[model samples]
Target: MLNIVLFGPPGAGKGTQSQKLIDTYSLIHLSTGDLLRSEIAAGTELGLRAKTLMDQGILVPDEVVIGMIDTKLKENRNAAGFIFDGFPRTVKQAESLDSLLDQNNTAISGMIALEVNEEELTKRLLLRGQTSGRPDDQNEELVRKRVQEYNTKTAPVAGYYANQGKYHAINGIGEIEEIFTEICEIIDSYATQLNA
Candidate 1:
């Protein structure tokens, strides 16, 4: 399996790159946010709980998020691999994911971190807000808070992966295609190593 973790800040285009990777490699895209939304939309028990917290503008507890992810992973067991986006945001979660994958006899192949300047992120986020209509994006204060939260809570996970020698930093400032190319190179390198 070619399991990958796509890690980056909010406006770093992790989603875009993940999509490209999925298309090129046929990896299952396992986005926590998307999974939660799907569960909520399906009105599952976990989704209901997550919806309550989300409705109140609070983050869902790690256990609930992990439960949702566990379900998705099972469903995609036959996939070529998985592209994890917006997950393992904490050290505990990262450890938990490792245990889960270990139990399944699989492991993370690599973590791709898209590196972008904070100023560029802010600018891109503001522009995205104009069209996205997401409340978090529309509110500057909320946007800043989200960025801070990412830096404080999620950024450390990069270091954790780096320590494992599975972290690759991709420069995120450039045309979309250029950035995708850079990411592709990293993925190709890992794929080669894995096949070898």
Candidate 2:
């Protein structure tokens, strides 16, 4: 399976680009945020716990996320590939992801990380909050905190992937299409090698 990790901070256009990648590559989108939201909507036990942590901008426990991913992997065993978004935020989680994929006889082909400046991310998120009604985006303080948290806690995950030569950072400041084109180019390069 052509498993890919779409790595980026909040408001870095990961969600937006994921749709295009999904359409172009026919990859199943595995967004932890979406999964948690579904559970939250259903009022599942995991959702309730995740909600509390998310409300405080804290990442949900790794075990909970790993379990969730286990289910997703089993559910999508026949998929061509999977685009992992909003996951593996920490090095430990990345290690866990590696083992999980190994168990399924697949590995992350690449990790595409969007490199967006803090200023732009803040602007994009606050603007989105106006219409998205997302509590996290609606508050500038919370948004910055989330970004800071990513820098402190999540940025190292990039290094983990880089160590394995599976990390590609793309500029996230250009027009959406332009940024996506850059991402596609990187993914295409990786896909070609995998296929060969």
lDDT of 2 by residue, 16-82 (tens): 9999999999999999999999999999999999999999999899999999899999998999899
**What's model 2's TM-score?**
0.98
Global local distance difference test of model 1: 0.85
lDDT of each: 0.85, 0.93
Task: Give the per-residue lDDT digits (tens) of candidate 1, residues 5-83.
Answer: 9998888998888898899999999888788888888999888988887655466788877777787778888888899
Best by lDDT: 2
What residue runs in model 1 are displaced by over 4 Å at the alpha carbon? Answer: 43-45, 55-58
Q: Using Cα atoms with residue i matched to residue i, what is each candidate's TM-score against the true structure? A: 0.91, 0.98
**Candidate 2: segments with Cα more than 4 A from true spot:** none
